[model samples]
Target: MGSQSIESGPIPACELMPASILISWHPPTTADVTVETVPPEVVEGENVLLLINSLPKNIVALAWYKGVHNMSHVLALYSLKYDISVTGLAHSGRETMYRNGSLLIQNFTRKDNGFYTLRTINSRGEYVSKTTTHVQVYTTLWMCEHPSISGKLTVESVPPSVAEGASVMLLVHHLPPNLLGFSWYRGVFLSEVREVSRYTMPLNLSMRAPAHSGRETLYSNGSLLLQNVTWKDIGFYTLQTLTTDLKNEVLHVQLEVETSFSTCCNSLTSAPVMIERVPRNVAVGGSILLLVHNAPDLQTFSWYKSMEKIDKFKIAEYSRAMNSMTWGPEQTRRQKVYTNGSMLLQDVTEKDAGFYTLQTLSRDLKIEVTRVQLHVYKPVRNPFIQATSNIVAVQSSVVITCFSQDTGISVHWFFNNQTLQLTKSMKLSPTKCRLTIDPVRREDAGDYQCEASNPISSKKSMPLSLIVLAF
Candidate 1:
């Protein structure tokens, strides 16, 4: 037989290299990227920047996502080479990207509260790094002061129930005119107690403890604003005020921070047979635990979607003996019945914005029923303002209209990042969406923005700078 010539186009590159050499080769390690909030905690109607740190040099592109690390929630994409940014489906026009891969959110609102993911891409369009950070947007609650006897200092805790993660104000009522300074203590006034903060009248300056949590604010009016309170904050707080003459007045107020799971009752007679929503304020697409507080040992319990206790509206029923659940025809997968007679509703929609009834039958043959109103609100969208003109002469009238697509929303105006105060010459339309300034003044030459808000969320428009030409 003649030798056969077997031909191949070319020998594979891997065949030219030893298998041992290939095993020694490894890909370059990517740097770890992290995101930080510039000011840490941000309040509503403010601006915050998501600062990116330790970004890899190979990263040529950056993208920001809203909730999860999903492309559909992309807010904006920035290209380092082009130095340009493109908005995505989730863009609200309030997000701006910088060359350093940082993102700036203007007019931040509660709707902006959640996790934000940053993805970095290399020149080859491969993901080099991804990091996520949570942003919490807080809402400031103004305290209402009631008059106390003059010259007598008093401390009043606002809202009664100081829920965790909620803000509380310890308002000082009947503040004496001759007040010199004040100090707030975490516990009752003691030499070894932790001093939250202190203010001095002479210096007009406030000093906080080195270990202060940065959540306490001592106001000029001698009030203390506590933000994002936790269970550990529950205790007696003492406020000591000193007069210019060196006389001191001490007062104490106890703070009871409520948690998601509250005590049923101290005594059987004091047991509360009521239903409460874990989160008092719930928005659409949110979950709520319709917790039954201090209900007697229940033999059976039923939950109705409507205020009426009719059987037709029943959504779920549970039996203690059988440890089983019976779902009604109206029940959906979103409804869950707990053994403790409580119900959890998830992914709530506008249709669930009504009253809910809970009926329980105890083993003692006593029946207890309670109803709670669930206001599931749709978050208000970002509003825009349209003015008659950007420039107005003194003594000329200018009408500004705010447009919002959400119903059941209230419109508010902000000037220079503060609530707009209406003057005698300023008139608002019936819906408060239209503001007419009969005569413009130089003071109105600053930025103006309109905020549309519901109980659930709020959003402000881009600032519209008004130029008032002096006549």
Candidate 2:
């Protein structure tokens, strides 16, 4: 076999093998096509000077495949490359001066995969091979150091129930070999760092939003460790090896939380209080019901709205027929008898607006202070509308809002007694419900009102007369 010297190029950093590059080629029909290679393993993000040497006259156009096929032969789009003088089938320069083709790749991604088959089809039918390399970038910049389970994982103290407050500490790792750390994210963004030497697992010691709590694990070497075990701690944790793109192993840890310290404080032993839900004011057509929760067992619950005590049997009958019975919620107008535990005011008009009390008779137990609020709203008159400017120019915007006294209601907006369009500028926010006309003109002045409604009844604010100003 005849051959010529090829130029050597620089190497990439993310590649393994330290200093050895893998090169392969096939023989073409002509013996004149002799090929040689210089530097094979080029450092990623660096420039490469590929020297493809061939017989004086056999240098053909350059062809480059950004990525080469591995044993499995999955075509990775990320594994593509570029060549400077790439034409259909022509060479830039020929023969004597070994063509110095500048093979530079930029902004490499994991998909930039690799390069190979740097060939020169020489005149003598014998092709020459320069250098080929397999390139892969770490998907993650960091890894876990002794990644362990978070503490909020619960058990039966319930084999598995997410705890109210707990966090798992994980040691993060950043290395060339442990670059794949997708597990830490679990397809979601993590609040922790990715590639640190150590990290604490997720922990939510605060029980503010318990339902939002979740589980995850940290893994290194072969073991999956868990931390802050709760009854919810009993579950399967998979240790996925990014190098293999599959689950290498799984860990099952069981943990539980016992009945923590008990005290008369916040415990059931405290004389429980009974509080009811009743609006202080109702519109011309509205209703109200009394509700008392967290009541101590057998504590006689009494309902008194405007000084009248409710009857117990009436509440029982109400319960039997209610779509769903709740402390005699079934009591209808026909039953007419209000129960001591519950009382319902139907089709409430302005006359029915007043303070309703849920009197608790832990009278025998008498140790806890129990009280709640009932603010009913009865519109003294139809809502009146107001605006900053009645004749605002077409290009100017205006704000319209509703105001009312304690109607015991969180209102939603309505147009012509139907649901109004909810948009960024026209909808109600937590602090205030407002309506804004992006550009008001003479035509926009009209009747508008805010209706506040709740589970029981609805009320509408007085209509505001709007008058738009035209420029």
Candidate 3:
């Protein structure tokens, strides 16, 4: 068999070229393959290197010797260098490596995890394999994925309230390579890792709140839990993660709690009222409660247009303990109108008017129920504005799209509110909320709004204002 010139520095073309890389014409009747270790078993802070064959006849693979890692599991890595007889050597993050059937060792790192596996395949079906290596790094290090704690955690360093004298259970989830010991901190300063009577998988720490104590215990898992929590248990706690391979990652834990019998203006107290649109072309109509669950004693029931209640549905009473609400004034006159904090008029005609609001009395505060605008029959979807490029000149195709968060959006192209004549550029693609404008001119730049709705609700997105600037 013949051979080719081997280059140094850059990886040779053979190793990375796939199946063809191992193909050598000279079939091995019998060949000698040797594996050697450069620096052998390593300690921290060291570099190791090794050489393959002297003759070097298409050397296929180089790898590391392996052993048990983390006292569990086996892993193999291959990153062989096939340059100038050097090939098939893998790296474990600048540490131990398997190079060309030779063991190449280096300084130990915390990330030198798992066992090492190296494989080699020659063109003639000859291959070498090495597996089973143990990796030992120093120190326990951990990090929380995304727990932002840059600025102030709480208002100030005011000690958070605790359970006065209850057991304060603190937990920390650790994923350390060489997890050793850990310490706790209150605020940013180092505090002792309180030894609790209970111990869990990660770290379970507990302590009795010192009477009127203004201290919050920080854990290794980057979390803070205040037990027997009180007003004083209000400040911020910091959890610092320590490891041998890296600097500590400090995480902030903010503590907050709402007192019982609290009052809120618009959150949780209100029902979920959402506009469900089909495609701006195909619309469906319906209505949902504005306020979900609030004070049971909903004494005043009112509907308003703008800010004034329509007085259409007389006052109603709701009782949470009673598990029901009473809205009187017979469901008459408006057939499609339902008084459940929201009223939907189906098969909506252009005559359908403006926004309606529902208000109720709860938690001692008179909060409006929900609001909805009765839109006339109109369809709108996503609007597409296409030009030659960002620098759109005259004679550009402008497409307006109409999409309904609700349904049945019959698109009506409007220049302002007045309808525009349907031209070739203003073609209507039925059931689709897409609009197209072509042969654009500076004159075509104006206010264009898409109206999308379903049988249930009608809505409009912010109008698109076309701006054409001459360069």
* Per-prediction backbone clash count: 0, 90, 81
Query: What's the TM for model 2?
Result: 0.25
TM-score of 3: 0.20
Q: Best lDDT goes to which candidate? A: 1
lDDT of 1 at 409: 65
Report the lDDT tens digits of candidate 2 across residue range 1-471: 111222212222112111112233454433222222222222334333334333334343333444343312211111112221212111112212223433434443444543433433332323444334333332221111111322222111122223434543332223124323333221111233321122222331112111223343434422223445443332123222233343232112222233232221365554234444445334456666654444534344443342224544223322222323234433445223243345556775554444344454443555332332233444432332334433345556666655433333355556545566644434343424446677555555566677655434556776656655443
Report the Cα lDDT for residue 204, model 1.
Answer: 88
Error at 40, model 2, angstroms: 77
lDDT of 2: 0.36
Off by over 4 Å in 2: 1-381, 414-418, 422-430, 441-446, 453-457, 465-471
lDDT tens digits by residue: candidate 1, 1-471: 111111221322232212232123223344365566766546689999988766788666667889853556767766666555666667787888777879999999989888887777665445666666667665442101111222356676786568778999998867777878888887554443488888888788998964358998888889999999876576567888899888888877766567533453455654546666778768889999987867758899988987568889999889989988898867999988888888888999989877677888887878876666676887777876756556567887777767665665678899999999998889997558878898888788888899888767999989988878774
- Each model's lDDT comes to 0.72, 0.36, 0.39
Poorest stretch of ten by lDDT in candidate 3: 138-147
> Pairs clashing in candidate 1?
none
Best by TM-score: 1
Look at candidate 3 and tell me the lDDT of residue 456.
37
